[model samples]
Target: MKIGKQDATYQLERFSKTQAEFDEHYEKDLQPIAEKLEEERQKTMSLAKEQAKKLIIPALVALAMIIFFDGFRIYVIAALAAYGAYLFKDVYEQRKKMRVKIKEQLLTALIQFLNPNFTYKPKSYVHRNQFIKSNIFKDDPNRYSGDDLIKGFVGNDDVDANGIKGTKTELSFSEIKAEKVEKYKDKNGKTQERVTTIFQGMIFVVDFNKDFEGLTTVVPKQKGLKISLPRFLSGEKGRRLEEVELEDMEFMDKFTVRTTDQIKARYILTPGFMRRLYEFATKKREVQPQNTQKPETLKEAVKVGLNVGGDQRRASQDARNVAYFSFRDGKMYFLLSTGKEHFESGLLTPINKSLVQEYYEDINKSLELVDELNLNLRIWSKE
Candidate 1:
């Protein structure tokens, strides 16, 4: 389904009506704390800026004087003066730490206000093992690092049309990033290394209600003859499980499927389910802009390459690269590498109703994936 501003507005209205007391509590209690933290952050930044001016102005003046004099002695003196000014680096670091602490405090308070059952950690992230298990990205521990983890439950003891009662679905999501080092010799014969991002995005894991065995990985189709040839030649050794051709030719063309068992794969990837995945992938692709414009200058080309290199690689793997699904160890993992930081607001900006509602809506979008894909449909397993 297309998630637009209407969904956000409706969710906000419903939340305002059902959770009026929570809003009142936030205004009364959390607002003061956030204001205090913002005030402290402003003061800290102002002090740092003042100190930077005091240090930098003198250094700039000394450098200018050295240039005007055009003497070796003056150059040496200016260099020493510049080095001395660097002594205040510790103070700058301290200011940065203070600002980060304040932001963490504000974020924590806001999250607590939003859902008492949920927890947020500014410095913590989903473990690398979990990422590898998810099979969303290439399993490379050396390249993975993440933070900004949030975990909680969504449903309660709510009854449904099928006479099934809702359970507390355990959900955890975090920002994850991976990088690869490109070591090459420059034209001057000097070795240079460029750290390029392999994958940068959020990963959300939901505990599936059904018990199942085997691993199923659904990945975007690999294009180009050169890339597809290696997998075709290597057979199953290339880690490409027997490709299950689906009934939907369009879906089959878009995604390459692999499964440990063909029978189970057919059971899991039903026509209805494949249609939902296809729609979600198509929606994400439609929203992404196709930049056909090329860089006008050499410098612009280099800059553009540096900025979009990782994106290019990710797109080659999956055009959208926004959402990926894998089932392993009886848990449904949604690897969403949209390259956007969700649930984060500007530190200086005051938290308003709209901002909070936006955060709620973004999270709801992730949670809704479980229902959207009908992941809890447990016909095969006796849950």
Candidate 2:
């Protein structure tokens, strides 16, 4: 199998010539282009940082002034004002950030929806061995306004260690619970063995009765919202929690919704952000004033509201009724419009049902596309 030394030498020389040519070409051509690109990127970043510094100069000036002025009360007031201004700026920025996140989450969902193989319509999809049917929430033209439909499914139940059998009171909210330690298929071809519950009957229709109306109630002294969710019956009681009152604070609304709609494999949007910027930009907008028509109290901080003058502005004391279909985790979050905002208090709300409907319908339409394209993409990736 051994070859002669002369033949080997000839092969080695040939290889050396090719290697030399490759090194020369790559260094002269590809390397320069890559280096130039890197340099341009650095320059762009440097310019951006410089611009940011210039924009922030006023904040620095305010800080320096506060430091220079030594009178105790004056200094404190000045410092507080400066900090407050910064806090306001930060809040506006954060709201915009949240909006962007929401947009991303929605885009991802829409992509998922568009795909036929992964996510078809809610109803008539094959789930494992079972062929189940589900209705797309938006597809139903007769959908109710608010969460009145969801509210009917909450009540006291006889949940024991053996498992939830039935409800104590014969109410619509008391749903017939279902368990899954084995395997079950939902209508959309999703296979899961996790224990879950679904509301039964024509009157009651829902699952995961948490934050009933998607309306969050803030805990009395806590910064977070207090949400109430039903505890499903699981086998074998633990040390203490198996025998607590249903109204126990420990079993309250602690589960935060996947509101942060950031998606790497989808589009997203944030709410109540751009409007806030517009508010701050235009100082002291004339809105509905209280009884006195003047600022007599402290709580009426809103300076923007109903301007009953312009027709195109669409000024009305009452906000329009709308609906919500928030998709998070693996479930759809639904909400109904409660009422319109009062026209007097500059309370423009989600009153335009048409606009809200369009948003919801568009999401439903886009979802299949999103699912088809974003099948294997990482859910939480921002990029």
Candidate 3:
């Protein structure tokens, strides 16, 4: 289901209908598993409570004895703690394994219900090299780690009855974390090392149906003190790349476009295409109220670096507002800092109809970007 300008509403309606069917299937199929999980959870909780109750009195008694006899205080506390750990170790391990199993099962079931063709890996993730090739984030490949990768096609591979051709788009998203160690001095003037998060969010990659050899990066505009910084100091190496300017004032105001070739950038970022990017960025900002509370206007949003992808050297840059865009090898990668965990099944909450609807909506939101950004509408490019 390609969501075009004229049929956005209709595509959503169709998705809603499909989601309703999935919801019914979920209730019918997953209810038994949910019930079993609930039972196991209650049993685990009861066992933990009983174990804690049995240990608390002894631990308190040991503490009181230590206060009276200072000689054996350390030994007494250590003994009590060791004993408590020994008592609960098996139960804790058992519960942990059970939870992992349940989580994997639920995720698999939910993903299958959404689309039988799709595959969900509870432990796999998008590779760091892929992130670098995507040019979404400017962190060292050694610093990147990710997990929980979901990949598959959405919509139909065949043409639908409405005369609309279904897109065979390959979509994948994963939770990514990139960190670097910084050496700094504390208040006491002693040098210390601290780990800083360079990028922590979901990185999404979609196959763009068209193949292009050049790289086009659309980052947020930089101004003020940042503009005066040297390329080396700024930690960005693509200064030699031509900065292409689009005709749309709003898009130009929102994004700083760069490409290996100026003509290719212009062809890729058409007025209609830039408008779609602007709209997507605007929608993402609006969804995150915590970050966009002060920016009331779209221009202000862009000025504050509301779009993804910004100057990597700006330490004070807000990761939530930044998204990185990269085009390479017939694929479009979008690095979004949503600042929250996604596709997680709750421990206590069952996978209900509403929950399934939310998952469906999120998947569609990602897929729609392929069409909305005009990724398939290639110009001056060979497929």
Candidate 4:
């Protein structure tokens, strides 16, 4: 199941459609959907503004009561809280529906334009079982949820490297949020549960239609340091896996490879593959904000800062853009730890061209990973 250089080039060419071509698709198919959603958005906001205007007088009265009438202050605050909720409940529900519409109607159409054969499911996600089976993370998450699932096939469907007609490369990914909840006692001696995020990003799994006999896990050097440490020293309760030492010092500096079979580990982590993995892990892709509406409140500003992930590298070299790779069961499982939330619409802004472009690029980047790792080369197999 291996392909030659010419076949590999052909596969790359087949999958690499220029951004201009996608822009054409966006203008033709997706633009109308966005425009229609914008119209609904305008109507919804108009009604919301009118309802919100009624709050100003009540708010002023509440403020005056707090200053002049101390006894009635609590009652006035409670009354205002209930009234505000009643006024905005419809608007909140409408905006919620609009978010769903953007994902279902607009994003779905964009995915179709990218590849008619590809399937986009907004509600479904990769199962938790697959995450556990990969064994990339040491601790299993107590809570798991995700959305924006994209599943499809790449490679030349017309002919295989051996002149057979079939596609061997299949790609699937989803935005996952996995967390671990731990219980602890506070200073008051009362037990409380603290939720810790284990992983928050995309879990990309590729079925390369090739088989491997060993499980090889590649983690960032810092994490590798912890895992590769002796059991007596680190107190690691997981399965003991031997570290695979490769000839490339640069790759070894950036990543730690642990495997069950030495020969198979070397077979997969060749010099070129190691270089690619290093570059992919070190390089940061910063996605600029698509929404034009600036944040008015401090909370909104803080949220925007986190979401855009301002252009700053981590203080530590090993801590920047951490990526994990596990090769097992004839599939390559990649866990990308991007802290920002992907493919979400801004609540304050209507759908626009820039927003649509952002979604397109975000998704297109994920699809390009197959080529980035040279997975379509099919240089080895389980035979």
Ranking the candidates on TM-score from highest down gives: 4, 3, 1, 2
Give the Å error, residue 30, model 1: 5.7
Q: Global CA lDDT of candidate 2, please?
A: 0.26
Candidate 2 per-residue lDDT, tens place, 1-383, comes to: 12111224223111011224334543554344434433443443344344335435555565566678655547666665565445345433433343343223332232232221222122121121110112112121221211111121112243457653332111111111122244778889899665422211111112322212211111112233122221211121331112111232321232122222123102221122112212222223222222325544322221121212112123133212122223322322222221221111111222222222222332332222122222112222222
| Regions more than 4 Å wrong, model 3 | 1-6, 9-26, 62-81, 155-167, 182-193, 221-239, 284-322, 343-365, 374-383
List RMSD in Å for every model shown.
Answer: 8.2, 26.9, 9.9, 5.4
Candidate 4 lDDT, 1-383, residue by residue in tens: 23322325335434544579778887888889999998987887776777777877887888899999999988999998788778877877777788889988999888877666679988889898877666767677899998888898765556646675545578888888888899999999999999977777778888855667557888777744333222211123454668888999988887778876788888788887787777767777653432446798634553453333222211123323357888886888888766456677544565878778767866775556665666766454232
Candidate 4, run of 10 with poorest lDDT: 309-318
Question: Among all windows of ten consecutive residues in candidate 1, which has the lowest summed lDDT?
Answer: 225-234
What TM-score does candidate 4 reach?
Answer: 0.81
Number of colliding residue pairs in each model: 0, 42, 3, 0
Each candidate's lDDT (Cα)? 0.58, 0.26, 0.61, 0.70
lDDT of 3 by residue, 84-157 (tens): 77776765665666547654776567666655667777678888777767654444545677767878865444
Give the Cα error of residue 315 in candidate 2, in Å: 41
Candidate with maximal lDDT: 4
Say which prediction, candidate 1 or candidate 2, comes out ahead on TM-score: 1
